[model samples]
Target: MRRTSSKYVRHSDEGELLWLRPPTRSGHVFIKVDPTNTSSARMAMGTQQVEVGGRIPVHRHDSQDEILFVYAGQGTVIVGDERAQFKAGTTVFIPQGVWHGVENTSDEPLQVVWVVSPPGLEAMFRDIGTPPGEEAKSLTPEEFAAVAERHGMRVKSH
Candidate 1:
């Protein structure tokens, strides 16, 4: 028998990132729809919205694999060596350690839903004295390096 998690949390993610909490310097408005709890899979699924003319900083998930589905509007997804324009129905796969970023160019918001397998980013926040569903802030160059090293993340200045 499988036991469901005892608690379910819900909150606004970021200031710019809206769905999570304190938005970050990258404007990552994200929402974790299915967290790492006892849900469908041992993964984290989320919806992402990019405000008009806004974009996220380039970064990579060094540990988990990710798949993103563009559901609305138009935008550019920079993945590793290439930047691709995406729209409704475009699905992109991001392997672990591949640099990726998103931008919204349309007058409307760019909407996307993504899945991150083997969820553990929650613990990442714990280690940094931050929390999920909170605005993501920009760290100093040194600070960014430290966190990147700690989380196995690769930050690409773009």
Candidate 2:
């Protein structure tokens, strides 16, 4: 079995975010570590740092389940039909193929360790991701569906 911590492998050597697709998000810094470079063979971990009022819009992993561990600050997680409040030490599990997003609602930045089983699919999101400065504020009902359809990701609204 492998042995390592992504926290150590993906951190910045120069005090900036590292090991993610790119620094294209204004509020988020994501570092994804999978079996190839991490210890968990059946899991992928992404360390995320998001500033206040920042968020990842509702999205889903078509083939993976996810667990979000709140390490600091306050946030809200919209999972399927419900929006749950979270704080440090909170853990939320999101089953596969459901829509979800994490929003930093506190005054301080939010930190979360997202665990995705059997690797994750954010690479595709990265590919289609709008750069930080070009991100959309919010999508209309039809617009949201179109975006997901373009990526072949189904948008589920409970």
Candidate 3:
């Protein structure tokens, strides 16, 4: 029998933090609620910090729908064929298989809280990100592509 508790709480600084480097993505991601830490099996939630001028390249999740709420700073967001201004308080819903991306256009860091249904993106994030205080190793573009592919994500080629 699987025994599980439904309650969970975490402080601002209390989460599994990871750092990502340039060319693919540049930011710090704090995974707060994931299958590894919580009892939920349907979704996962986290906060991502994208530095000024940083961008999360266009990509599509084959099986997960994602929701992103901007918590601070400003940027540009591409959803499918549309480009829109993304700022603090802005929210977006991206359906599965739809291509989307974000670029931080402000001088300050762009902080966004993201939730994905059918919890799987976190796995890809874990594979790509370096833990805080660890020797950061950046993945080659080819390597990144391979990992993304394995995670049911297809990134747009430049």
TM-score of 1: 0.65
CA RMSD for every model?
A: 6.1, 6.4, 3.7
What is the descending lDDT order? Answer: 3, 2, 1
All candidates: TM-score:
0.65, 0.64, 0.93
Q: Model 3 over residues 1-95: C-alpha lDDT tens digits?
A: 11224348767777778898866888889888888888779999989999988988899999999999999999999999999997899999999
Error of 3 at 151 (Å): 0.8
| Predicted structure with the largest TM-score when compared to the true one | 3
> Among all windows of ten consecutive residues in candidate 1, which has the lowest summed lDDT?
14-23
Best by lDDT: 3
* Winner of 1 and 3 under lDDT: 3
User: Candidate 3 overall Cα lDDT vs. reference?
Assistant: 0.88
- Backbone clashes in candidate 2 total 0
Q: For model 3, where is the 10-residue window of minimal lDDT?
A: 1-10
Off by over 4 Å in 3: 1-7
> What shift in Å separates residue 154 of candidate 1 from its native position after superposition?
1.9
